[model samples]
Target: PDPTRAESKTVKTTCPYCGVGCGVLATLTDTPTGPQVTVKGDPDHPANKGRLCSKGSALAETLSLDGRLLHPTISGAQASWESALSQVASRFKQTIEAHGPDSVAFYVSGQLLTEDYYVANKLMKGFIGSANIDTNSRLCMASSVAGHKRAFGTDTVPGQYEDLEQADLIVLVGSNLAWCHPVLYQRIAAAKSARPAMKIINIDPRRTASSDLADLHLALTPGSDVALFNHLLTTIHEMGAVDSAFVAQHVDGFDAALSAASSGEVQATGLSANELAEFTRAWIGTEKVVTIYSQGVNQSTSGSDKVNAILNCHLATGRIGRPGMGPFSVTGQPNAMGGREVGGLANMMACHLDLENAGHRATVRDFWQAPTLPEAAGLKAVDMFRAVGDGRIKALWVMCTNPVVSMPEADRVKAAIANCDFVVVSDMYGDTDTAKLADIVLPATGWGEKTGTVTNSERCISRQRPFLPAPGTARHDWDVLAEVGRRMGWQAEFAYESPAEILREYATLSGLAAQHGKDFDISALSDLTEVEYDALPPQHWPLTKERRGGRFFADGRFFTPSGRANMLPLHHRAPAKPADATHPFILNTGRIRDQWHTMSRSGLAPRLNQHMAEPYLEIHPTDATTLGLQAADLAEVSSAHGRAILRVLLSDKVKPGAVFAPMHWTSQLSSAGRIDAVVAAEVDPVSGQPESKATPVAITKLPAR
Candidate 1:
């Protein structure tokens, strides 16, 4: 073949980092040194239109096979695929036989492809007769899911990414968009530059890079989002901004919700009267406004209530599901939305169906020919690890995530996994903190070597086509799940040939769910052949023949039993654990700009690591001085749960009584930088999502070594 022709081989895929779902073009060429892959933004994709963030641009550098687990292993010895699969099937079967299905659990992750998530959910919930399957998404977007279901009768995002650019005003709550979601930030920044009159409001406890573009920044008290939004709701009512006709016709619980909002004290927001007046005026004045939230909103003890408070403001003013108005949730992981569609959450069934709904459960059971299905939700992330620690869950399967480092009370989580009766970890790297404690380790293909699909934060499903070959004995996660399912004696149900076949089955089931009035309907693509599936383009959901992908609830029609949105009567609640004299400072944890979770992939790139080399703590200058600490000094931060020593970076960004730390470092990367170990295990009552942002802790400068 001609050199030019050979070098022209390129595949259009999706970024494996954030939920922005930016399209990527991976081009392969043969060089004298070896095979080289170059990745760039795909200009044809709608999500980003050729905009790539630092992490996405450095994708090619992370594909090296260094330190990769090339084959399956059992008890630190290499094992054949057949042997590993048989052992996994046998142990899981024996565990269920002895302790019932609830005794075994599958802890999956958002890094998995849609196909992988679907198979894992099916095998655990259908074949295994239990709902004990949960994804790491439980730690990020579960609050949004719970709030959506309570309000709309289903988990549905109202608007798309375009709303951010089209809106007259944008309210960002608990999100560091510039560092966490760079491409979306770039889009909003560009839109504002073009239309200078557009307004932006940043509401966060700490001043962040995203605040640079804000016309106003509200650094309110931590865990006070409900109070802030409640104040806004009452202000809208007083200003006569309520859409009376819309509320009367298409909303429920308005009287009670408004009464609750009226009772909330504006002082709880920790904002001055002038700031409150200015914020409410802009929000009530702008008819086209979008409220975007992320982990900062979701990872809280009152996360669900906080979500409803924001939704209440949008609903009261009829500013939702329209072109430039709605409450939008930006997921932290690439496939968190896809996992939601496939019932990766313990409380859900496939395609936005409720596990507690008898009719919905029956429909899925009949479609899958399942022997039995659990009628109740299972253990969530925090509870799952608790069960493991207490010996209630005997067998555990961890796939594609490092719970040992990422989970709250992580030291206990690490100890639980280490002492569990049996543990199986499926990942690309075997030496990760979690994998080191596993009884069995299964090698799996990573981003560039996997072929599947993922749904982004905006509900767009994009294909992730492979541009390189699998490194060694590694296999796709979907393939591994299917093989295990077959070994578990569900041959016919699990006899999937390819990712295309799995997508077809999932889509067909989604059609059944749509028949039951669910919001997730992608049945139009169920008839695609292998070639058609392989060449599928990025598209939005609700892809039926009559209606293609776009916004939901735009026509004032919701999936609720009463056909009206429900505005919850929410009251402001404080964080679960309050700061005391011993631990007088609250600890906030989050992600950094360059590093991804646990740094399995992003850490491999030296350029990415250069952004912020070591794990450090962000503290206010006043707090640093009060604690007898100086910049670059090592500080020991301790909570009731655990402690860590981090380099101190004194800045006024953080409040005087609060400190912030990134959650990316692990035991493998740093000796004592696993921040989650210091996070409390408190969770929201409704959503079961851990409260990661406000753990009470105490800090002191470490002595010289």
Candidate 2:
């Protein structure tokens, strides 16, 4: 190689962290010390145009093989891949034969690639003949999926990332983009700077970094998003901002939806009259608007309704599918969208097919050549663990996720996994709380060593190509799942020779779905050869020559049976568990800027720890004083479900009666900072998403302990 070309060995991949799906160019080089790799933003990729955040910049550092589970293990001892996988397959088979198929479950994660998710969903829902497979993503974007299906007749995101830049008015609700999605936030800031006339609004309980860019910040009451958006919908009607022609042409159930919105009390949102009026004015005045939401809107008992409330405003105003328009929901995980695409949720079938619809289920079954297919929905994340604890799920396989640390009422979840008859965990690290209790552990490749595709929040699918070799005895997650499927006697169905073959099959199946008038389609790429697959570029779905830009709803046509959008009647519902005299403070849990879920990957990078070395609680000064607490004071926060001890940091950012803690810390990282231990297991009635935020708790200073 020429001297100048010595530094040019690279592979294009996707970031494994946030749903931003920023393209990364991993360059490999040789140094006297050893091999070195550096990650830079892929300049040609559309999501971030050569921009990376703090966490993405440190990804190379996080990929070290230190403390990795280099080979499969049984009860913390090394085991051959064959013996471990054989035992897993046999145990799952025996459990199903004895207790029925429903007794076995697969609790996977969004950390998995699309290929891995595809195989797992197929095995549990099609071959094994049960819908007993659910992912940690159910905790992230399930509400958005439910809301979209109820309204659009399918789970579809209409606009692209460019919509944010083109939007004249950007409304962010329950999201701290500056910390969670730094690149997209930078894009919004740049867009505002380019067009100074562009306006922004932030609607959240805490005044976060995202609020800094907002011209108006409505620090509303927690779980009151429905009230605020319903009020906005009613005001839009009053102001004649409703798209009368669009309503008459393409919308249904407007009268009932508007009536429900009219019945909601604006005061319930905890916004002053002036603040409410200002928000209404901003919405009515702006023609080009985009409303973005995140975990804050999804992690609640009424999360689905909250999602609809935001959608109702956009739908009623005829703002969707075009540039600078529509309700935009960004996901927390890199493949949450991809997981949705492949039916990783309990209630769904592959390619956006509904498990409830016999025809849709048949379409997927026929495409998979499956002998049996599940008809009804299975256990969700919270319910799955409850089943595990109750001995309903006799065999459980958890892949690429740490449910014991991340699940609501997590301590109980850990106990449930520990007592399960058979438990298998496949991950890069073997020390996770989930892995510690597994009967069998499978070593799997991590980000830089995995080859597959991931979809971002914008519905763009990008390749996560491998630039480095797999470590030790590790294998790709998809390969492991595929091998197990072969052992389970689904030889032909799981006979995937490479990730490329799996992608082709998935694409072909998607085309079959599109032929049946489903919204998911990538048939144009179904004929790609291995070379084409390796050189695949980031592309949006429902792909066709006509769908070149990958945008949907341009013609006001939806995938609904009537080809019309359905406006659901939504009402505000309070959090399932309320704060009271005993546990008066509302405990809010979320991620910090530099850490990912359970800190499995992000924790490996010591540089990421520089941001926040330890977990602490964010309490208001008043709440701190009432609890006899000071900054850095040790506090024991107890809830109805569990308790944790966290260092206290008093700040006005939190509401007087509420405090916040990051959900990233785990048992391995901290002795008692796992906030999910106390988060109630309350779930949304419709979406089945747990209310991770707003768990009622009490705090007391720990007497200088």
Candidate 3:
């Protein structure tokens, strides 16, 4: 070993944790012992110029080998890769042969790179000929996808990050950007400071720190967003702000949509007419309004309808695809957009192609050179678990996410995995709730040690390069899956020496689909060699050599059959579970400023824990008084699905009938703080996204017993 002073080098990569997609400058240094990495913000990156949030900033610290699954372990014993791969393939093959294609499933993650998502989707949908593949993103942003598909003719985000700064009015509906999307929120705050005339509106039920910056904070009732937006639509039209020419030329279904948004119908939405009038006037009066929404609007029974209602206003005013206009869905995961581009969702095929369409399926099958492709839509998040619970899915391959802790009715999900015939988990960390149930564990590389590309919420695709060698026997996720594919008898197709090679192949497939009118075409990178792919600069897609970075829908050309966006008619629907006489309080779940989902990485940082040390229920002061509970008093919140005991934080932030809980903690952190355990498994019918945000529960002061 070399005993002299170690050398250090910097590697550029994208953050793997969140959708902020901050670029990192990873510095690898050789000490007397071994190599270490120090991560800093990439000042030149467009998303977060010279800034990283707490989670992104601590990337290096989370790269250690602590509790890392180093090699394949079967039945708690070390196993050869040969044996492991063979067993996985043979068992899957046998299961499919005996029980049919739908009997097997692949549950993947948002943390995986685009190449990884592509390979997993290919294995299940292309090789296995089953659409039983779904990602953890199903839990996060599926509603946004369904909503965008209905309104935009494609699951496309119509604006760029620059629109946030350029907008005269930026309304954050059901999103806590300051905490969840820290860098983006910082950009908006800076933009507001520079332009004092700009207005900021926060429309969440909780008065979070993000609301501190809002010029108008509407602490509206829980699950009342669709109603709020529908009222705004009616008011906007009444104020004569409708762009009739644009409506006639570029959109359809407005007549029914308008009728649905009228005063009489919107009055049942629980919002005061005066408040609705003011909000509508402000939105329509401001020419450049960028309305940003997230999980709040998307994670509901009427999630798609909520999304359509918001888009209806923007479409009526012809306000989309221009500077400071359009309805933007800020994704929760870093590669959520990339996953969408690669069609990681169950109902989608590669390159924004739909699985239900025969033509799209044929094109994707031809592009992959795949012998056969799954022609029908697969089970989504909730349904996938239900299938497993019902004994229909015998084998499941879970990658990079702990659904046991994150999914609603999580305890039942854990039981379903436990009852499955075979379960394989691939992850860097070994102690996750999902990993605890695995029959085999495959070690995979993490953030600074892996290389791939990730698309952010803005659709910017940037390269994520490896700064350090793979620790222990851990390999790249795509390599592991590809190796398994080869063992499964798809040798030639799965052969790839490196991630860059896999990406090049994926790019070629995307280019072939680009000939069609899909939004995720990457024809520009079709000619890139492995070296070129590895060194590829940041670029946005629909990327052609001729056109580089730009916003979508600028020309008003949509991917729909009519080449126009659709005005989906939507009416207000209450949350699946609303506060009632028996369950007299509404429980709203969301992310806190410090931690990410499941507390896998963010929980590693002690400073991050200081924000809100543990799980506590936030209730209105009046409700606390009515329930005979005081601040810091223990209260038991129970729903039809499960129950949990949480400490109370009485505040005026919540409405009289509502309570708030952070969605990050799990049983690993606290014995009685698994919020998802208590949350009902009600999901959006169209999107399959669980309504983790709102659940009806009764709260009472805990007895001394």
- Writing each residue's lDDT as its tens digit, candidate 3 over 1-705 gives 557988899888898777988888999999988888888999989998879988888777776566777878887788877788788889998998899888999888888999999899888888889988898898778988998888776888888899999999999998999888999999999999999999999988778878989988887766677778777877778888899988888888888888877745655546676767668778989999999999888888888888888888888889998888889999999998888888888888888888888887888787667878887789998899988988999999999898898889988898999999999999887768888888988888887778889999999998888777787788888998998888888888899887777777777787667666777777778777887987887777768766776877778777788987788767677788767888888888888888988888788777788888999999998888989999898899998788888889988877788888888887778878888887888988898888887888989899755
What overall lDDT goes with each candidate model?
Answer: 0.94, 0.90, 0.85
List candidate 2 stretches off by more than 4 Å. 1-8
How many pairs of residues collide in each model? 0, 0, 0
- Global Cα lDDT for candidate 1: 0.94
Residues 1-705 of candidate 1 have per-residue lDDT tens digits of 655444548999999999999999999888655688999999989899999999999999999999999989999999999999999999999999999999999999998999999999999999999899998999999999999998998999999999999999999999999999999999999999999999999999999999999999999999999999999998898888899999999999999999998885778879999999999999999999999999989999999999999998888999998999999999999999999999999999999988888999999999999998899999999999999999999999999999999999999999999999999999999999999999999999999999999999999999999988888899999999999999999999999999999999999999999988899999998999999999999999989889988899889988998889999888888899989999999999999999999999999999999999999999999988888999999999999999999999998999999999999999978999999999999999999999999999999899978
The regions of model 1 sitting more than 4 angstroms off are 2-6
Error of 3 at 210 (Å): 1.5
- Kindly report which residue pairs in candidate 2 clash with one another: none
If both were scored by TM-score, which would come out higher, candidate 2 or candidate 3?
2
Report the Cα RMSD per candidate.
1.0, 1.4, 1.7
- List clashing residue pairs in candidate 3: none
TM-score top scorer: 1
Q: How many clashing residue pairs, candidate 3?
A: 0
